[model samples]
Target: MSLMEISCIFPVTDIKKTACFYVSKLGYKAVEYLECKEAHICLYRDKTEIILLQAQTKNIFPNRELYGYGYDAYLYTDDQEKLEKEFLEKGVKIVKPLNVTDYKNKEFVIEDIDGRWIAFGLKIKD
Candidate 1:
């Protein structure tokens, strides 16, 4: 057997709003959009795929902070610096600025409208 692709699904308060953000702010394409009792949106960027689902029931906890966790997603990008600058210009909610971690990755964190923490980064090679 062979493993295929994977898509991360997030429970957002509003699918349309989140999709717009992903499309405009994060540079993703709306592959599918659906609204009903439960809203669902599928976004694609290059080979990456992200899905946003309108949360009906209450979540176990609020954002990652209140949940005592962090980093809902780690988005790997080759052009980290340029993308970070673009996000800043777009006034994206940055949880943290770009910095080299001990693990040696140049990375920054972005907070979505729903408070999901997404870390975007690239490897720092010596």
Candidate 2:
């Protein structure tokens, strides 16, 4: 069996605010399922999908906060410059601009409304 595309699941304190951020700032379309047993908001943009779940606590603990240094998600993209430019124009909070990492990946990191760092880029070939 082959694995398909991966989707991110975020636990946010406020689903509406987080959904708004994804829609307004990050160019995503959102649909809420608040009436369900597990309330969530599904954010979709191109091939990316993010499910925002209602957090039990007021605060979220991202991987960086727990592990000291780690991105919550890494999205592979072929056009990093264009994506970065679009995000910049849309007023998205870019924590790290597009640059080649030491690991040889050209990527840019953006901080979401809940303080989760999401990187977008692809690894360079030698």
Candidate 3:
């Protein structure tokens, strides 16, 4: 079966606050923000779209817990350095510094406003 586009839906405490972070810090635009009973917002950046849904509780995993409680998001991009620089300048908490993994992947990880682990990586060249 052929698959189309796949986007993420993250549960957050507040949609406006979370949406603002993506817009101001991560360079995402708020495509849709519904402030009804179920607060929700949709952010768009380049060809990617992320949906933030207001939830009652949070399920953020600790940095050390990399096993069962997995990362909330894992993303790949070509502009790794540019994104790292931008995130650093914005005072974003880069949990892990950019480095080459033993698996030969050059990547870094960052935590979002909702405490979700978002990892970005790029393939390393020989």
Model 3 Cα RMSD, 1 decimal: 2.7
Could you tell which candidate, 1 or 2, scores higher by lDDT? 2
lDDT of 2 by residue, 19-125 (tens): 99999988899988999999999999999999999999988998999999999999888999999999999988999999999999999999988899999999999
Which stretches of model 1 miss by more than 4 angstroms?
Answer: 33-39, 58-63
RMSD of each: 2.5, 0.9, 2.7
- The better-scoring model by TM-score among 2 and 3 is 2
My TM-score estimates for the predictions, one after another, are 0.83, 0.96, 0.83
- Native-vs-model 1 lDDT? 0.82
lDDT of 3 at 49: 84
How high is the CA lDDT of each candidate model? 0.82, 0.94, 0.82
Residue-by-residue lDDT tens digits, candidate 3, 5-97: 878988777778889999998989896657477667888888788988877775644444756565677788888888899999998889888
State residue 97's C-alpha deviation in candidate 3, in Å: 0.9
Candidate 1: tens digits of C-alpha lDDT, residues 37-100: 5557889988789988877765524356676776888888888789889998988998789899
Candidate 3 residue spans exceeding 4 A from truth: 35-39, 58-69
* Total clashes for model 1: 0
Clashing pairs in 3: none
